[model samples]
Each structure stands twice: as C-alpha cells, then as structure tokens.
Target: MSDKKRRQRLVQWPRVALTTGGVVLAAAATTFVVRTGDAASITADSGATPTRTVVAIPGPRTSTPPPAPVTVTVPGLPVETPVRVTPPGAAAAPLAQVQVNSAEIVYTVAGNQRPDDPVTITYADEAGALRTVENVSLPWRLTVIPTVPVNYVTASSNGSQLNCWITDAHGATVAASTDNTISATCNR
Candidate 1:
C-alpha cells in the first residue's frame, strides 16, 4: 500500500505483541497465587484444629477393711502367761542353717625365712558340722630347710570341744594341747 499505511501497520504490530505478553504474564501470576492460597488453607485447617475424646477404665470404687485379729493359747502354760501364736499364713520362716564340708588354708610370705620372723596364715572353714575343729601352729623343730613350712590341721568331733596338738616334722611339740571347735589360724 502507501508509505503512511505501512508505518501505521508496523506500530500496531508492536502494540499487539506487548498486549499479548501482558495477558500471558497475568494469567501465570493468577494461577500461581490461586494454587499457593489453596495449599496454605489446606495445611492450616489440618494442623490448627484437633478432636478431643475421653477414655474410661473400670475398677472397684472403694477399698475394703482388713480382717480382725484372732487369739490363741498354748497348753501347759499358766493362764496368765498366754502365748500369742501367729496365724498359719501370716508370717514366713526367717532363719536358715547351712552346712560346710572341709577347711582350706592360704599362706603368704613377705621375705626370706627366719626362725624369729612370724609366719602369716589364713584359714577358710568349710566344714558343715558346727563342732569341727581346725588347728594352726608352728613346728617345734628349728631345722633350716629350703622353705619354711606352715601347717594346717583339722579335727573331727561330735562334741563342741576339739582337743588337738601341733608339732613339727621332728615330732616335737610346737603348741601344746589346744581345744577349739571352730576353725582357727595361728602363727608362731
């Protein structure tokens, strides 16, 4: 067409392009805003409110009173000296006894052996019977040997007293007759 007509058409093309770009940008912004607002409302509704409910458990409402005490009397006792015996299911047995079989000795040395230096001895009583006796004493012989010997001797008896003697390898008396039922350790 003419020169003025071509110039007007070129100007109109730029305006149309700008209006199309503005409409596309507005549509994208509206979609983003609407989607973000819906997501925020869903999260707030789920988290901000909570439902409440009560649970009940059943049992006895009140406690019961204890049973009354019962009295008991033993025969052969005086009327004034009434013995109070506990009911069958009231209390349990308290005391117990254990029996042992044998005894053991543990010895320790500090330095070189000398006739005057005292020896140390330890005894563990494992005898079951209460009347068993364990004796500890040094030998009478003063002979110098490779190692100084400490003796542990045990005696058995039905009675409480245990009478025994401690002697050296030479048969000489280290300690005279001693009486003890329980286990003991002595150093000379």
Candidate 2:
C-alpha cells in the first residue's frame, strides 16, 4: 500500500477506538445511575398508552458547620504588701523582742545496772513526736526542747534496778520511774 493510505488507516483506527470508549463510558454511567435509584424510567406498549414515571430528585447536600474556636482567659493574681500596726498607747515592738515559752526537757536513765548492759530510750521530741534510741549504754541522757503540753521518757533495760528521771528547765524533776526488772517510765 501507499504511504498516504497507510497513514489515513492509522488515524481512522484511533478515532474508532475513541468513539467506542466514549460509548462504553456513557453506558456505564447510565447503569450506575439506575442502580443507585437516581434515574427516571417510563414504559409503553405497542397498542397501549404510554405511562409517565416520576423520580424523586434529592435536595442539595448539606453538612453541619464546624464549631467555632474557643478561648479562655485567666486573671493575674493581685500583689500583696506586708503591713505593720502598733497599739494606740504601746510602742512598736521589734521581731527579736518577741519571746516564746520554750522549756528544756532532760531525760536521764541511771541505776545500779552494769556498764555492759544496754538500754532502749524512747521519748517525745519538741514537736510531740516519738523518737527511739535502741541498744544504748547506761547513764543515757538526752536533752530536748518541749513545745507540747505533755512530754514523756521511757527506758527499757535487761539489767537490774533501772531508774529514769525527767527534769524540766528549772532543774526540777517532773516525772520519775524506777523498775528493778525491765522498764522505767517518766512523764510530765
């Protein structure tokens, strides 16, 4: 064949393929519309009247709008300043002049016990908290400041004749206990 005839045949093949592809796509789209209940159909017979069919067209699609952005604000704290006031007739007192009624508590444990005998000392500290000293030798002494109303000292020993004493800040014995076998307690 001639070159010009061969070229014309090649161009005609492309046109034919494009037309077939367009027809197939149109048919597929129509089938999808019928299957999804989006198409209208009508029927008629050779000797009967044509029938009109109505299809419910859907409304415009709508979606809920997204919520607005939220913002929160916190107020800043107010500034505070210390204030001092004096009595109408009395002068202002300095902070150092303020006195606290603190007392010294002396816990002493002594007896005719042997030097090798160990003892246990239990007492309340200034803040009314119990403290324990385990395996302590005889002639045990502990001094503390008493801030609570009640203070106590207890001693336990396996030695013979254990005596305990609790002295106040005035060098006076407030509580004393003596035990010949195991334990001695002093409370004030």
Candidate 3:
C-alpha cells in the first residue's frame, strides 16, 4: 500500500473504534438506569409503542411484634386475673367479669347531725387507702366496691349524735355504731 493510504487508514481506525466505544457506553448507561429504576419511562425505537413506566415497591418493615395477652391465676382463688395487653393503634378488649378478691360494701352515715354542722368522714378505699372527706353533710351514703377483703368508715364530730353502719351486698350489717360521742367508727 502507499504511504498516504496507510496513514489515512490508521487515523480512520481510531475514529471507528471511538465511535463504537461511545455507543457501547451509552447502551450500558441506559441499561443501568432502567435496572436501578432511576428513569421514569422509556420509549421504543420506532416510537409507535406506548411508553413503559418503572415502579419500585417497597418491602415490609423490620419491627418487633406485639406482646400477647397474659393470664395470671392467684393461689386459693377460683377466678383468674388477666393482665391487659394491647398493641399500637388497636382497641383493647373490655375487661369483663373481674370478680376475684373483691366485694361490694355499703357505708352509711346517718344521724341527727344537721346539714350546717358537717362532720369529718374517713373511709378505707378499695385499695385500702385512707381517704378523708372533711365537712361532709349528714345522711351521707357511699357504696364502695372494695378490691381488698375488708372496708371501714368513721364519722367524727363534737357531740353531733352520729350513727355509722357498714353493710354487705346482701343488706347484712357487718358493723354498727350509734353513739352520741366524739367519733363513731364502723368496720368490717
């Protein structure tokens, strides 16, 4: 071959190689973008077909599951006490029929004590906590559903002729006090 023809062929070979390499790089980039879901849509060569859309659906999140309900039975008791457990955004089950180690007691404080002359009344609550109610009017009645075994109430006044009584659910008198003294206590 001639010198000029050989030189021309060498220059033309590099151009051809560069053009092919550029096309290959472009095709690789397009494939990468489609696989990674970076492109929203892609069109066919003929432009006659509908554009294809790409979507990415996320998987479920990694989280700890909710705790289950627990039931605890007390010794010597026929009923079982349930420990309430509820998950997030869930309605808890209603605690019905929880009648273990509990009873209904009625407390009455009726006397000749006038309404203007109120007395201090102290009672043991369902949790065995002493709750004092001062300046209470006469003929005060309280029905306490005690969680403990026993309950009591006391009415205190200065020569008020007070009367106090504690009764059970069956209207049986557990304790009574009808003294016209400084304090009258009824315990059961």
Top candidate by TM-score: 3
2 or 3, which is superior by lDDT?
A: 3
Better of 2 and 3 by TM-score: 3
lDDT of 1 by residue, 1-188 (tens): 99999999998999999999999999999999999988867865665433233222211111232243444433323345333443212233557653322222222111123344333323222232122222323322112121224443343333233333333332333433343443223333
Which candidate leads in lDDT? 3
Model 3, range 92-183, lDDT digits (tens) per residue? 35588533223677787877785467699999998889999999887788888888876889999866778787766645567778775668
lDDT of 3: 0.67
Model 2 regions lying over 4 Å from their true place: 1-102
lDDT value, candidate 1, whole model? 0.38
Structural similarity to truth (TM-score) of each candidate:
0.25, 0.43, 0.44
Tens digits of lDDT, candidate 2, 11-115: 899999999999999999989988655322221223233333322221111132223223332222233332333211122455676543347767777666666
**Which runs in model 3 stand beyond 4 Å of their true positions?**
1-102
lDDT: worst 10-residue window of model 2? 53-62
